[model samples]
Target chain A: MTQPTARSGDRFLAAQPRGTGVQSANLADLLERVLDKGIVIAGDIRVNLLDIELLTIKIRLLIASVDRAREMGIDWWEHDPSLSSGKRGLALENRRLRERIGELEAGRTGRRTQSPDADYEDDETPPARPRRTRSTP
Target chain B: MTTPDLTWLYAVARDVEDGALDGLTGVADEPLRTLTVTGLALVVGSVPRSGFDERALQRRLADLQWLEAAVRAHHRVIAELARTGRTLPLRFATLYRDDRGAAAFLRGAGPRLRAALERVADRAEWGVKAYLAGAAPAPADIAAPADRPGTAYLLRRRAQRDALAQRFDEAMAAAREIHAALAALADRAAEHPLQSAEASGRAEPMLLNGAYLVDRERVADFGAAATELGRRFSGVRLELTGPWPPYSFADIGPEVPETVDPAGTGTAETAEADVEADVEAEAGFGADAGPDAATGAAPRIKPPEPRSPEQPAAAEGG
Candidate 1:
């Protein structure tokens, strides 16, 4: 199985499939395929008095049963940061954190207590008064 | 009287002596008995009654689970058959009320069924799935250029997408070359898969989805060609499976209906199409086109074999 470059077994195996994809199989492809494809028999599971809900249920049962596929499902949503995989939420959360840090930094620049950024502020503004004098009498 | 549930029917070699298949079982854990016709074993079954009504059976097929059980049972036996020798498979969901029914059909099927089975004797089927890998680069969201506003940015992004799209088409071009080389070794094949919804949902693009029915003796050359392609495209994945039954080769033609099952995508469609096509190519393929033989498993339309394999490749590419 080794090529001239002698890549790892994982790489070779990965390349052995019908190679097509932005990346290797994603949750959607894996879920779509493993659940539906392969040599299936026409069974009662395929027949109900009603509608397409069985397909949905089949997916739910299938997703829940496959431990890693489900775990990967969560990862794709969180880590991939795409519209489907929940990446938008991650991006918003990041932006929100950045804003909060900016607000806190602005507050620190002009607090009544010790000003951590006081020295860095080259522009002078008038001081109100001394804090200790008001406390004495 | 009642077998309670549907049982499976299996196809074994006509020459597989009765004692040779002694321990074999059909669907319901029953002893396997061959359905012989003109001294040939047409089928073996686990059915209870000596007969069944076809009209009722068609209605019964609506149950997917029953269908699945029967297919799984059929597949189990077919797989075992492969371990021993070549077998022309019956279409999925084929049933006989009992051995007597199976035998009756075999006897009635006559020369047509015999010729079909013999045509596939000493041969096997192998599956090759070739998908075009990311013919496209990663999606790009280029920042708005300082130079333009209204339509320019949209145009650039569109241009980027189109450029990436061509990459797969190019990969497909090469894959077809490989497919052509492989097809030459086989006696016959199913339709070439073209639909790509799965690959579209995928990160990469799929180029081909195909199956081949070749003589048993040439499996090595087939694998070698595949392995060579694997090496050449070490960049591509060339998924291969089976030496399984002539699931692709068993051809009675499309009398049975097949609903649009899109999962297997292009490959399944082509395989489905090939079932019809191979039959049109020749009759008495070995003689017995078993009862459901003309059903969904065989090719419907047969085209003249090209004077040479190179011509089809040239035609497709051209």
Candidate 2:
């Protein structure tokens, strides 16, 4: 709204408008509005709010990108302890990036404006290369 | 010994009678207090002593289940008071040292709070959510297949995906228009466009989420309009929730933009550095229609204890 918005993360605050046991279409908008924007009132409670403070920030940071997070190793949210096959793939990509950096340093004499997407350079199944020409079988 | 050092916080509104909703209490019997400035009552509740420490509050707020429950609880009681008067809710977690504190905050926020109440006055908040349902549209649905080397194959697949996507986009646009039409019949639209893609990987990622402030008495007309629109659009999922407090129209506060890198470890927050996020651009959280853990339908919270400790509803988002 045009009014000064309430910055999130005040440990001790009050209630916002809430609905019934039903969420509507503008659920996202309302969620952001009710959750994000509001009247600003910084508080000073005698007791320190250290414990629950980080909880919101920690999980608040998790609000978006949890799907991509799944692709990585931090699967804590899912409660999965064992690493998934994707972890190995991610490791491979990291190795390739390291090697690509090594190559760029050697090739450009330590100066480079752009980097290539090197992880996908090797493709035993790549269909873009020219077909082989054989004389006779 | 002092009384837990607990302070009460509440939401108030312009035009709500001073004594309109005094005795309301939230879960755990937290007495609701009202702060008035320029004729608006700022309704609020207290923060228990235990949650006072920054460290403790941080830890608890991070717990999805805990945060969700707290927010849901706050919403419930505020909604109850909304029945008799015009109201604007405070941001979740607002606290004070005592009645004087509540009054001081309200008094200080006098102009801003009153304006907000005025904006949502005589209006109600309703939500509409749409999902792209085909087993969660595959990533390939968003991007062209990298393996399709030949121009024809790539072009064909690209065309197919584009057509489907166009249809989806058009349908979503239609839904927005539908919401607009219905809202015109009542109150104003709360904020900006909200895309639910941030909460992906679920069976439904809430394709379109919006909140509208409408007149309370015209709630039936609003629902009927939505119903007719629902009939008009067969393939899309259309649901309307609430005669809720004007959450969409009210001011909670500015958001701290939270960004997750997706690189295994990521975090979300709001910064004033022009950093924008899709979640911030939207409204509302949790399903208002779920089993009430206390009795009826409780708000949908991230499962505290996931069936598999490994998957602790880590998949959930704002």
Candidate 3:
């Protein structure tokens, strides 16, 4: 598979054969391992705990923005069963309730569209949200 | 007044030959140097205090660009050293006032560091992450009866959701089975927190984020086992990365107080004895040896013997 976002480091290491101990060039892979793993030794210079927490939050935002750009139109969460099961079910339930409310409103007003039921058929499709892809540094 | 340069310690290892780091540069493009103490080589670099001092580092770490460059540089140096011998990679941004300070740390932490080096010797870490394959299975097309479109739509949606929930359960089961199989083949295994879709840069939900510490000779077998597991479980895709510098396995216990004097002192000697006793205790209980001891930790599975002469060397270095 071609990696469109492969950095120069990845391209350089790609020439090496598999199982040759090449480090991954993926930024996320690097950050996760480097920041989280490794032995902790106290240094003469004291790094504040608050500063580390702030740095972690910043890194998370940076990763989120980068991914948002790369996967502009793909909202995996909407269809992800593991992640959205409860939320998606609730959304479906709410939409059905709203359709019922619309039917009642139309009946009371006596001003119904020719095929109110047919108009609501498209509710099976997920609603499209505006996609925002912010450029990351 | 210009502040003195701080010593940035990258990693610790034994028997790092002379000139092993001849051309290597570390974070801040400083020349790499080895400060040998207690029979361990401390791979280090000199970074300007102006940039690396605690206050400056906290600010610089927030800048993504600077963080990336410095991180990559740090890994590059450690990776190079790892090629030469077993290395205990230190956490990023571990710095000291000078060589003397770094030496003080090594002296205080000597026995623990040595045991860590022994634990990781002739072994490398491999990362295996499993992701659910393919886009969410397109909602199955169960034809809704034409007569009552509204009822049919609702039924169809419910069926689709049900099927998805079932698939999610199956996928999770597959992840656990895969981890068990791989863990059986490794000396040590670690389950890191799963990365978010944003962090993984993949649309698929990550199922397993695992690191395995495999003997150098078994690197090939471990990779093959992962590949076979991927094939057997068609729904999950496995990404195998490394022979990494044993970052996940580099825990050398908590920091020793800097007040402990260099090797000759009573406090340092007593600390060293305590570390030796701890190491012996760990060795006695093979299953409980590592920090990330997996459940049902099998006695260290010896890799199948008979590796090609070139394989070990190739797996050790790029």
lDDT top scorer: 3
User: Worst ten-residue run, lDDT, model 2 chain A?
Assistant: A3-12
Runs in model 1 with CA error above 4 Å?
A1-64, A67-137, B1-8, B17-24, B48-66, B138-146, B149-155, B192-205, B231-236, B252-318
- Scored by lDDT, model 1 comes in at 0.43
lDDT of 2 at B188: 61
TM-score of chain A of each: 0.26, 0.21, 0.24
Taking all chains together, each candidate's TM-score versus the true structure is 0.52, 0.51, 0.67
Interface RMSD for candidate number 1? 17.8
Q: Which ten residues in a row have the lowest lDDT in candidate 3 chain B?
A: B299-308
Model 2 RMSD in angstroms: 19.6
True contacts kept of each: 0.00, 0.22, 0.44
For model 1 the local lDDT of residue B144 reads 65
Docking quality of model 2: it rates as incorrect
User: Which is the leading candidate under TM-score?
Assistant: 3
Give per-candidate clash totals.
Answer: 51, 101, 0
TM-score of 1: 0.52
DockQ of each: 0.02, 0.10, 0.19
